[model samples]
Target: MVSDFRRKKLLHMYKFLDKDGSGTIDKKDFQLAAESMTKQRGWKEGDALYKESLDMTDLVWNALQKAGDANNDGEVSADEWVTMWDTISKSAADREWLSQYCKFIFKMQDFNNDGFIDSDDYVAARSIAGTSKEDAVAAFQKLAQGKSKISLTDFQKLWDEYFLSEDPNAPGNFIAGKSSFD
Candidate 1:
């Protein structure tokens, strides 16, 4: 039931993510990608193959493997990579779980449920989400869409999409939880 447009987009993104062209990504792939991204952003100098800390590389490798390897093959087929990214991209528009997650975020953000997420409200949620102040503010700004406040409907839409996709009962949420946190 996947549409042509969405399918094409996913395929495109997969190519962009597969920097190594090895037909399969490993920890080295993520490290290279991260280093490239950092250098592209002008965070470092020179064209040398910058190395990420072992711990950081391990985390990225594990995340990509879990999210993109759909066939339990320990590697990502192009189709699997495309599907995984497409699902994440599509989640923004999903309405069910987004609504619930938004409510939770709002209630958590609003502190007293005063129908608004003020600076203080945002601070609390940021702390809870373990995001830095700048990141938290940026995330809110993006989610709020330049609005001064987020409506329940908006929150719900975002929440449902973000959370329901991970729900065990969700149709495409059948990802094998390889890790306990998964």
Candidate 2:
């Protein structure tokens, strides 16, 4: 059984990730998410960020679809999400896979290939995830912890906190760019 807290988080995540509002997460949802991030960041057709976003989208879709698809269906329903979440939580976290995905996420948000994410880049990425620039700025201020830039390691740590930490005030809590986890 999924823990109450984890279950809640998963549902909250699913709600945001269900890009089509279809009550399920599918390939189109991931694709749209990538497209939105790229578009929000003004990544043009030939831009590397645009291509990277698309690649990241495919990776996420491939991983989740394989694990979360039940009954051979392409969509991941609430029940399936629960099952998949529990499974992932039980298994040891794969550092290699996590590292790759984290790299992709940080790269897409880097904007300038500067090896760090600044306020502008952070806001751009969050905007695609449903946050306003103002909100993202506020969150990033706290998340940055007096730093002007966020390294890939910082972003990855935040990513882990978002998934694994129970602390309400965790700096990484806003990894999804949402102040409200509801």
Candidate 3:
């Protein structure tokens, strides 16, 4: 069973994934996310980085469809997404996909490629996702825990907690910005 706290977090995640605001997640959302990221990074078509980004997004989309599209409908609804997370949360072994995605997002958020996610990186990355700068800053402060930056290892732990932790006060609760916790 998904707790209220976890359900809220999962819903927030679903909203983020539904890039077209279509109330469901499909391959198009992943493509939109990739395009947005590449545009934010100024990586034009034919650029190696742009191609690599698209490939990565494709991998994520394929994995998501396989794991979350329970009805084989090629799209995942909020209920399916929640059920998938609930199942994944119960099995440590099933969390590999989540871990991989967390790493991928960490890399994306580390816009400077400096091996760390500072306030600037967090704000910029969240902004691309349509989060307000103030909310992003607040989230960064909470996730960073007074540190100047967040390392990949720390980010992985936080990402895991964000999805699996039922504790409302967990810092990971803030990872998606204020709206997640609110």
Q: List model 3 lDDT by residue over 50-163, tens digit each.
A: 998898899888888998899998999999999988888888766666777888889889999999999999999898877899999999999999999999999998998888
Q: How does each model score on TM-score?
A: 0.39, 0.82, 0.94
Model 2 stretches with alpha carbons more than 4 Å out:
1-3, 42-49, 93-96
Q: State which candidate, 1 or 2, has the greater lDDT.
A: 2
Worst 10 residues of 2 by lDDT: 89-98
Once fitted onto the true fold, the runs of candidate 3 whose alpha carbons sit more than 4 angstroms away are 179-182
Ranking by lDDT: 3, 2, 1
Query: Distance from true position, residue 176, model 2, in Å?
Result: 1.6
Highest lDDT: which candidate? 3
RMSD of each: 13.2, 2.5, 1.4
Report the backbone clash tally of model 3: 0
Best-to-worst order by TM-score is 3, 2, 1
Q: State the TM-score for model 1.
A: 0.39
Model 1: number of clashes? 10
On residues 1-182, what C-alpha lDDT tens digit does candidate 2 reach at each position?
76566567668888888988999999999888887877777888899768877987888788777777877788899989878767665675534455677788788778778999999988877776778888999988988889999998898888777666666778877776666654
Candidate 1 local lDDT, residue 164: 33
